[model samples]
Target: MAKKPEPQLPLGSSSTLRGLTESFSFHSSPESFITSRILAFHKEHPDIVDTRAVVRAKVLNRNVAIVSSHAQIQQVLANDAAGYEAGGAYDELMAPFFPSPNLLLTDGGKHEAMRRTWEERMGSLKENVIPLVHQQTTEHFSEPSTSEIDLYDSMKTLSWKILLGTFLGLEHRDKLFETTEGLQENLLRGQFSLFPVTVNTGFWHSPRKKGKEAKRKLQAQTLAHFKEKESACPFATTDDGALEDIANHSVLFTSSLAVKALASILTALVLNLYLYSKEDGRSLAESLASESDPGRRSQRLRSILLETERLSPPIVGVMRRSTRENIIPSTGEQADVKIPKGWDCWLYFVGGGRDPAAFGSTWDAFDPERYINASIPQGAAFGSGPKACLGRELIREIALAMAETCIGLGIRMQGNIAARGVRGWLGWEPNDAVKPADWAQDMKQLPTQRPSEPVMVRVARS
Candidate 1:
């Protein structure tokens, strides 16, 4: 194939269509600034709704189309959710790794069916999931809590393990943990390839293909190991009989992103919970600490996580391309702006989740307790309608357990000292330790870690 285009461009020279086609372009652009900018933008960019300027808006291509608006985002995600699809977006970007078809990124009934089947298999562990989460917590906490660990990396591992338990049904986890750990790391690293151009050196492809073959091979090995274990899983569907549908897609890659995304989101949520428990957070932690019972504490934590998701998004939002013919709705006078059949549209979910109209007065606060009487409107935090995040339960369970472990170990983002690394993607890192908290003024807080909002307590063991 001809040489792929380079990844970088001088500021202001990039076009919206070209920006989306390339990976990591936003890093140097003003969008990078928006990713780090505060809730103030929510006030500044009313049309984009809590975002940067129109110049910033025009760069993140949704579909093949080169433009998007909050209104278009609403229609793509909430209005015609089932009608619009995520496959095209996934195909152009994620196809290299997943190779096989995936439901989480696909459209229609097929996506729904795949989601349902995975849910059925995962349901077997409904009760087991929480316990496993608790166990995972204990294991993480059992280690020296004083050491500054990358909570971001740590959460990724824990989430991946939980995913393994749910997907492969591994009973004797002690022996399986290490191998799976390596595999999970390798697999998650493949997302680095999402950069489109191979120039993002620090990010695997960074500025060029440095560890290209090595990264690909490691990713392959990780999936192969997963496939082997998956075959052994009693839950595995047979290729011969009625279970053939399982063979239709690359379950390993298809499922990995959800696990990775869930892991990232869960890690950020727990960080928020830990921070919130502090005197600084919205003060939800005190109630959490007050509750001596672990189950009740977990429930309180769950509400806190959901509220955090609402206030601050893990990824901001999903990108969509208008594939079929249709005019944008909710645009008011601009409804006829002519979004031709093939174009890209970015749904501004961060603003949508925090919209005062959608989330109410405390939308910008760290009030997990506020969630009790109040209700949050539907959003694209875990995606909007059709492609809504299917691992919702799993992400919640694992995150709660992570909080449980942190409560038990007293692990925290040392030093109100926090910093963000590698674009806003590092989330927020606590300087006292390797832990990262919320980087943005995310109505969401330190990685949703914004303290002063939450309150926390520990179980006094005899």
Candidate 2:
């Protein structure tokens, strides 16, 4: 019997291509641009997925190829011959925050060694991190706040506390935790500078300078704390250069980079569950809480989380720079596209997750049952291949613990919740019909997709 051939993606020039100014605007509001421009392109050219395809364009004054197809994206990420390198752009963008190269910015042997060291230092996640997360989450919801709470802010604070406790051996009430929290916030703020350069002159007031100073202080404090409590610290080690490595890795866990990513995911997940409860006329929390079988509850929880991630991925896209000129082979009949050396390749996770070919025709709909059998791809939310996120397991554990705790406590939303600029229940919904004035009014699109405006929801026991 003859098998059906896969559909070919268009190699033709993109009709929705953006120029320099438009590209700059796209970066400023990527979700909005994707909703308005990219999806529209897909609709107009339906043969691709019935519309899953790649679009090439100039982004941030760089020659960029945006890959959206699930299989093709996986191939690009896994293929060394594709010439895509993860470190160049990451190092440049994150230099202000991370004084030394952390795991995200290292590759090959250095990356492997660092990952192994961190894994060893982390010990058993089930034994160590899970218990800590459970404890923190339980304490957080033990006395549920009977007041309107900003969901994003609350989640951010909780994530920061958990990360600090897990890695630095600092309790939430510890003096060092209080002191380093402010420094970490300031350091994160520095990364948002209009110009990505740091001026070190004492006469000038620069965010990057302040950020650099904060990083120095934070690292020094972390090192001293580790030295003082070597026996107690989870990451403590006596190996040569271990202290420096731990301190350097601290920037990754404690900074906005890791903390914000987890927070955004939690915020999105809770919001989705709340919305689902509203639509279904039953509390998902109660449903999970009422289930007697542990396996069923776990499975249902996993499915719900997966669905939420597919709809609203925390990290929308990742940037990879080409190491050399090379051709990216197509999964279908389309000819390979020649990528120039040093060109930036943006892997669009949001788009890939929504690709109808992989996710079915009703890709936009939130359906947890689709994940029950584990037959579908989970998408690139945590990334793929060698460059996949190292903290993925920890993230899952934290998210599961937090979700269970919040629901088990009977926390219910008090009012209508909305992000400032973005629309739809999930906040990052793609709607091409929206006016330009309303797009990205108050949202951060890169690094993570989160609302800049407060997403306020009053909490009370149901």
Best candidate, TM-score: 2
Q: Mind giving the per-residue lDDT tens digits that candidate 1 earns over 9-51?
A: 1112235566553434332322233443333444564453322
Regions of model 1 farther than 4 Å from truth: 1-74, 169-191, 194-260, 277-286, 292-299, 331-338, 405-414, 417-462
Model 2 Cα lDDT, one tens digit per residue, 1-462: 444444333333333444656577667876566555555765775554324445666655566777766766776677652367778756656765785777877776787787787777665654677778878877766666767788889888888878888878788888888888888877877776655577767688688778878888888888787777885456536774877777777766778767888888898787766645535576566677778998999899888888777767788878788887766665454445566677777788877787777887667666756689788888678778777877777788788878877777677765454443444425234433334445477677666778767888776665
Per-prediction TM-score, please? 0.68, 0.86
Report the number of the highest-lDDT candidate.
Answer: 2
In order, the Cα lDDT scores of the candidates are: 0.49, 0.71
